[model samples]
Target chain A: MKKKHIYIYSPSSAVRDKAAYRRGIQRLQALGHEVEVDEAALSTYQRFAGDDRTRVAALSRAAASRADVALISRGGYGLTRILDAIPCKAIAKAIERGTEFVGLSDFTALQCALFAKTGAVSWSGPALGEDFGAEDGPDEIMEACFDDLLQGQGEGTGWRVPPREAEMLAGFRGLHGATLWGGNLCVLTSLLGTPYFPAVDKGVLFLEDVNEHPYRIERMLDQLRHAGVLARQKAVLLGHFTGTRKLPHDRGFDMRTVADRLRGLIKAPVLTGLPFGHVPTKVLLPVGAKVEVAADGRDVFMVWGHRHAPGHRAH
Target chain B: MKKKHIYIYSPSSAVRDKAAYRRGIQRLQALGHEVEVDEAALSTYQRFAGDDRTRVAALSRAAASRADVALISRGGYGLTRILDAIPCKAIAKAIERGTEFVGLSDFTALQCALFAKTGAVSWSGPALGEDFGAEDGPDEIMEACFDDLLQGQGEGTGWRVPPREAEMLAGFRGLHGATLWGGNLCVLTSLLGTPYFPAVDKGVLFLEDVNEHPYRIERMLDQLRHAGVLARQKAVLLGHFTGTRKLPHDRGFDMRTVADRLRGLIKAPVLTGLPFGHVPTKVLLPVGAKVEVAADGRDVFMVWGHRHAPGHRAH
Candidate 1:
């Protein structure tokens, strides 16, 4: 594979760990990839990576730089503040030039905004500091999956969930051309009723979150469900929800119970255990990509791009 | 004043404190009001006041009961689940018969749905168990305010906030007939993009919440602002936000800082210290009511209903 240029920048909240950011850049270079760090990546303005102007300028610069991939340095709580000011057309132009804009969590806002404003697809996967710069190094699965995606070899990803989820997915077998979308639940929910929200019809929406309890998750899903967003989807994928603390008030209602309630409410199939979100071993997914999904017993496979061959089957 | 017929029911989460429910009923009765408890009020199904069918039935019955006041027993996580099954027309008819549906927190969903579906005004105030049946008895301010509202005497409520907030409110002076809407921030945000969200134009939106930190609060506010809801409001009154624990990651950002950031982003005046929401000494606010507001130094007064007399101006 040709050596790809990766432009690393921070578009959200400030990255507090300077050492991790340095290590991340080093690792990317060591992996035989050309890395360019944004001038504002280390700039701090309050809790943000920089002031709104600085972050916006950095993003605009990255988009115009024409890198093969523009990866976020970290994800926090800043992109939302600068959504209106972001150079969407520039970013879309970058995507037109084959830049796979990638990051998760707060990046969901930017990705969704890009899709809404330009109908361009971006990768919903790892960040530089959080994933590549982990103290123990990136998880093998994540690194391999990312490498394949960057090399244009990873056309699809597969994972096995609990057997019960197979029953859920069975209801939606042979569903074809479903637009695959969604990322961090809270960020996605934040875009609701806003111009930045994408009006994707019959899309397979996958969601994940961190540090939010079942009730909060349920509330966000309820918002989407009530908004008629859920009924228009071919399927709803559930990824990992971590860093939550159980409260005494929950009474027996947990994430599973929440999922059950959602299954009862939404017309679309609700399948769990997708390898995505705030987890180490995750797949690189293309947001806004048309894909086909199938289930075989306890296994679920999602195929997109060139991987959706005529003879391909879920087995 | 005539004895008011007050219907007490649990239409959302179940009330684990049965004793408190009973005490609340006794308090209403002691205040010379006829209290009708819905049969399903005490029924428990998981964390809900009852199953969806039962809760929906109770709400429909309350709306059709034609009581002077329909007060919820408590607020929790259930109303969003049964939003579809709710009888909006029936509730509107009940409001037509002079029933003032009231509650906060999760009740925001039901209240906003009512306003959206039928444009009926409800109360964003106390609940039966949590407010009237408080362990220390109903708060004097809350009790007095409730009395005044039930007797049609509390046409307006006023409170003093920090003098600095007066500058924020100054931008909206002479603003009349701003539809006063909104409740718990999270619940209101949940209604965003949903059919049940009221498209209030140039309204005075008041928001309050519990157990949410500054970042979360700021995120929700950003959503509303980005959605153009905040820009459409004549003023944004912030009520009590309590019960949140400070996280180490917050650095120096706090509720005050969050308010400052919102003031910068929104076009409307952002005033703080409204006497409402998840607090003991709250003022009963008429949700969806058309009202006028004015700021005098450190004092803010909101006047609605027939109390807008020539001589009844803010001091």
Candidate 2:
């Protein structure tokens, strides 16, 4: 395997699995890859201490500049705060120089922003949070993501879901040409009017959320529909929105309800129960990658990463 | 107190509070008024299902033909789905006849639509969810809402949230005149590209949310900002976004952060921690009610509406 230089940047929450972060750094070192940990990025104090912004901005720039890969420490609650403040142009230019970015959850804001502002396709995968030093995450997910992005391997496949009888309805057309965009649904919706989320038309939008009720999910979906987002998309792919606390009076508006709502509004195919998002066995997808959605009648297949040669960068 | 007929209409979920709906019915009945329940107006199984759109249209026509009070049951999630289905012309004619309209939350969509389609100032306050229940709601809230609409019994008070602390920054000037609109932040955002949420260039926009985390709140606020909704508002009044479940990282971006984010984006004064929205002790406001926003540094007062007379309707 090629030696990859990964720079870790997280300038928000300092205490979000400190041990795991150190352990990951050790693991990367043991693997003989060059891993740079910018400790300055871990300066966030009690959420939005004014200090975190400057540090986050600086670390974002530094991580993007010299590293072959930029690894966000964890998905914490501080990216959006520093989004406008961060030097997006500098980060974009770094991507132009070729640097792979990776993170999910709160990191989604940064990933989306990188794509929107810089046209850099960033991956949403394991961060230093629950995935690191944990057996919960499938080893295949980690290997597939690293091989595809770092090793510049061909299209990484294997998109599967546990047994479910909900058949894909009439809308699943196996065509995906648009940029793969989205992260946490709630966070993505939050980016509605900001410069972070550029015009998302004809994009295969993917989203996931955790610990929200079905009604709340319905509300967020309603917001997206009202915003004319769902109608504009070519396909709506839902990640596993787990830990959904259903209200007593909630009438079947589960993940299925969300899918139905999207199906009702959009002409595009709406597919739910994807293995990505906040689920344990999550797959990785780049926010800005041009990909294809191959859906047979039974299950949808995500052909992540375009056909890139070992030495070529799409950007 | 004179006897007056009370009609209850909801977008969806508000009908479940049997106590509130029943009390509202009984309150009017005990006062020797004909208490009427618009079962079609109540938010039910399918929201607008069995809503009897034709009858609703006819009722609006009859009431508008005679200038009657038409109270909406509750607010949840159905109005927009029934927009084209609802008899717009009849509702508009009724508003023209000075028929009073009321409701909030999901009902905000309907109320905003009524205002856009017509010119009636719809009232937003205690709904059939709590108004007609066995347990009495705040008397002041009920009196202020119905009294103002029925008999011009109270001032069309603009609206305001008490300051969070003694030391707080205030921006934007005093004494402004624009449209008063908005409801559940998620719901209003949903109305973005649709005909429901018209261009309120310099309006005093009101917003609220329920059960969403801080990041979710920030994301929704971000969406509003991105959609040009936040930047255009003259001033923003935030209501109670209560009991948001704790996210993995509860950053400082609660309601205060939401207000701050709005403040950062727009030159308008952003007020937070209002006793409205999903909270119990909320004040009623009239959407499309042209009112004044007054701020004397220490005190911010929104005073509008006229008070009801003694002989008008049962009080």
Candidate 3:
């Protein structure tokens, strides 16, 4: 793969683990990529990467970096606070120039807002510290996917549904031309009534989250359903919902129940096990891109094609 | 005070503490009120009082009970799932007949939906197990507030703002004829883009929550702000945002900061220390009712007046 220039910035929580962040930058260099770090990328104030203005300025720098890709340091909580001030036009222009914006979690705020404001696509993938700098070394699959994104050779990704749910998702086969839109469920749900929420009709919405209880997940999905979001979707994809603490009082209630209940509520086909979330073996997904979905028994695949070619302008 | 009929129903989480639930009924009975418990009030299906249809039936029975006030067994998580099937007309008719619906947390969904669908008022106050059945005994303030509701004498409620914030809130005085709405921050936020969210312009929005970190609180408030809800409000009254687990990374980003940052974001007066939320000394406030706000030094009073007389139809 050809070497790529990666721009790193912090638009969310502060970098509490500087060593891990440093390791991530080193790992990117080891992979033969030129990395540029934003001046305020390591800045801190309270629980944020910096105050709102600093983070917004950091985002502005990322958009104007002219690098091949702009990646987030980590995802915690900040982007939503700076949504109003995000340079959406510059971001969309950067995407137009083939600079793919990549991050997840809090970055969902930026992805959705950019799409809502300018209809530009962004990547929902790894963060620097959390993904590339994992203590056990970066997972091979994730690194390969990131490389594929850089090389523009990735057409799509696929995963096998859990055995029990395989048959339940058989009907989710063969969907084409549906706009793909969604990211961290909590962040996406927070944009519900705000102008930042994307207005994509019949989109293939995929969602994942970390450290959220099943009940809260169900509540957020119910909110989307109540807001008529789910009804307008062609299909609903569930990625990994990780790091939840279940209480004894929850009894048999969990993510499975939440998904089952959601399936019963909405008419769209709901499929699970997308292998994209806060897990090590995750795949890169394109937010606000048109895609085709297919399933062979339990193996589900979403093909966004090689839409990253310069001036392609899939949107 | 004249004896009033109190209908107890389980529209949300199941009664996990049977003893506490029983004590609540006993306390209400001992207080000289005719207490009627819905047949499915104690029924359980996983974490809910019953399954969706069962809970919906329980809500129907509560609305039909014609009791002076209908109270919830407890709040955990349930109501959002059944929002579509909730009997809005029946609830409105019940309120028209002087049956005031009451509860908090999950019940906020129903309150907002009721107001949006039929312009009916519900009470944002105590639940049976947590409030009336406390091991130490029901809080006198909560009991008095409940009594005030039962007797049609709760014209208003007041509390003293924190001393440091007193001067910051002097301008919050004299807000007249604004709708008093909002309950359980998380639940209320989940209804944002949904039809369930009330369209109350120039309202006084009061919010409270439990187990949410200050970041989550700020994110939710920012959502309301971005959605234009806060700007349209006459004022924002923040009750106790309780049960947070602060991390070392917070570094002083707490509720005070959340309030201060919010005050800077919008023009409406943002006042804190309303005696409500998941606390022992919570005061009842009528959701969807018109209210007047006044401040004297550090004290804030929200006056809803007694608008429950027959055929009054304040809406």
Better of 1 and 3 by lDDT: 3
Model 1 per-residue lDDT tens digits across residues B176-226: 888999999999999899898999998999999998877888889999988
Better of 1 and 3 by DockQ: 3
Q: Interface Cα RMSD per model, in Å? A: 1.5, 3.7, 0.6
Best by lDDT: 3
lDDT of all predictions:
0.86, 0.64, 0.91
In order, the candidates keep a fraction of the true contacts of 0.69, 0.41, 0.87
Clashes of 1: 2
CAPRI category for model 3: high
lDDT per residue (tens digit) for residues A26-130 in model 2: 767666788876756555554542364565565566646568778767665667666766666777666666776777887777777777887777778877545
Candidate 3, after superposition: displacement of residue A85 in Å? 0.4
Query: Could you tell me which 10 consecutive residues in candidate 1 chain A have the lowest summed lDDT?
Result: A306-315
Candidate 1 collision pairs = A14-A49, B14-B49
